[model samples]
Target: MHLFSAVPRGVLTLLFASLLLSLADAHSYFIVTSPTQGTQLQNGAANRITWIKGLLDDIDAFDVEMSRLSVDGLILVARDVPAGSGSFNLFLQDVPSADDYYLLFLNSTSGVMFTTSSRFSIGDSSSNATATEPDSSAPTVTISGGPNPLNDFATTFPPSANGVAMPGWKAIEGSKGQLIGLFTAMMLCMAGGAFTLL
Candidate 1:
């Protein structure tokens, strides 16, 4: 009878520990990328707010909620992002005028977990001024140095003694004909240069 009672107590203790561990591991990690903190946007403009959650772990989906503070400084506008997989890209449209401020929250559908806060002021978007320009005048330019034309060229590998070599570069001589080909090409180039000089 003592053995039976001890077994029950041990089982209960294990259950309690497991519950504590589960609760501790329930929080999710998320990052807000777009409409960054302290960003300003214009009213009725498209605002792209980005967030990432649990990048290391495989999750089913997540959600985002956005709200606006009213004239009385209260949370008035609230929106929710539906369940989806991978990273989160939420494009909120028709953001209200400058008189309002937004507070955004992310929660995982798997559990009641949030990533980070999405806060911003409307009517003062960062990109709003760029969109309002009417003049198509070319942007001012101040050239300081000569043009760098070859800056975009792909990097070329040097001649390889043991690995595969690049074109116009010599490879190590083998039982095959790579070294011979290189020798021939170099001789031809030298002869051409001599003829040109003559």
Candidate 2:
């Protein structure tokens, strides 16, 4: 019997399954820890952003995108946060001017989505918020991953291998691009073996 024909069907099945798992999409459970939703933050006051695991499985390194937008949709501040593991504490410095509301977004490397929490203007005065001291018990917002499989979340780019917190982004549906890539690889592998048999 030829070597290719002699190969068991179960062996081929196992190989396919392995490939599926490797290409299987991964997700993260992101949540906001500090500054509960709907809470008011004073201008120029330092507020800490709290988040759970922010890394997506396919992400190579940790990177965070922070943005502060005005009520008129003006961008006040935007930058990258250094990547790390587990729980993360992010600082909001140089707060926006005369802004009624602002949103914070976070993402993880292995995560397929981005989580967000918003804080509205606290007062009308132009006084600056004290730096360094963050109100620990100021009604922290808690974010968690959904138990349902069809989790709809927005994903951030340049995934952090061990990112703790990411900026706020809306959830989106799974990517067709990734699924198509997996199937194409399977077909190529199968064709290679068939040509050898001939």
Candidate 3:
């Protein structure tokens, strides 16, 4: 009997399950917000930030902060606020000058945090937004409680001898291109002995 065929049906089933799991999607690690992405904000506008409920399975209630739009880590647009029930509003009392700002969401329980993909402008201030030297005295945001291995969160795991990915490989749903590539590979693998004689 061929070695592949001799493999027990139960083992094959386990292999299939593992393969399926590797294809499963991972957690959405962003602060879901109400402001249309890239929308210019009005001075003193109503900014609504929401927690992505059920993300990471058990985490909820995060502390939110807005960075004063700088690549270097020294500027906060606003102090941190609690997002209870996964939603909260930001009232710009002083009416910040129109400019791009990055939002940070830190999980209160785990200290896990995710930042906005890019800076979002406050009102129609992009053209008027001027670059200023980042203040050396500004507080730097310290990130903590990241994944066991930060690379593992964004990278797909290698296939094991049985052609199944190491336990927790999952595709990030936000990345459409990578997802398509993964799907293509998934199909090709099934056809190419990854599941031979299945």
Positional deviation of 103 in candidate 3, in angstroms? Answer: 0.8
Query: Which scores higher on lDDT, 1 or 2?
Result: 2
Q: What is candidate 2's local distance difference test score? A: 0.43
In terms of lDDT, model 3 sits at: 0.45
- The lDDT per prediction is 0.40, 0.43, 0.45
What does candidate 3's lDDT look like per residue over 1-198, in tens digits? 555677666686678667655655454345465444564444433445444543443332334545554433423333333233444444443434445566665642466775453456664323453222222433222222211322211111122224333343343443454566578667756754554555
Best by TM-score: 3
Candidate 2 lDDT by residue in tens digits, 42-81: 4434455555543553323333333345333223122233
Where does candidate 3 stray beyond 4 Å? 1-31, 71-84, 108-111, 115-118, 124-198
Off by over 4 Å in 1: 1-28, 56-58, 70-94, 107-113, 124-198
Q: Which residue pairs in model 3 clash with each other?
A: 41-123
| Model 3 TM-score on a 0 to 1 scale | 0.42
Error of 1 at 9 (Å): 25
Better of 2 and 3 by lDDT: 3
Query: Residue 184 CA error for candidate 1 (Å)?
Result: 65
TM-score of 2: 0.36
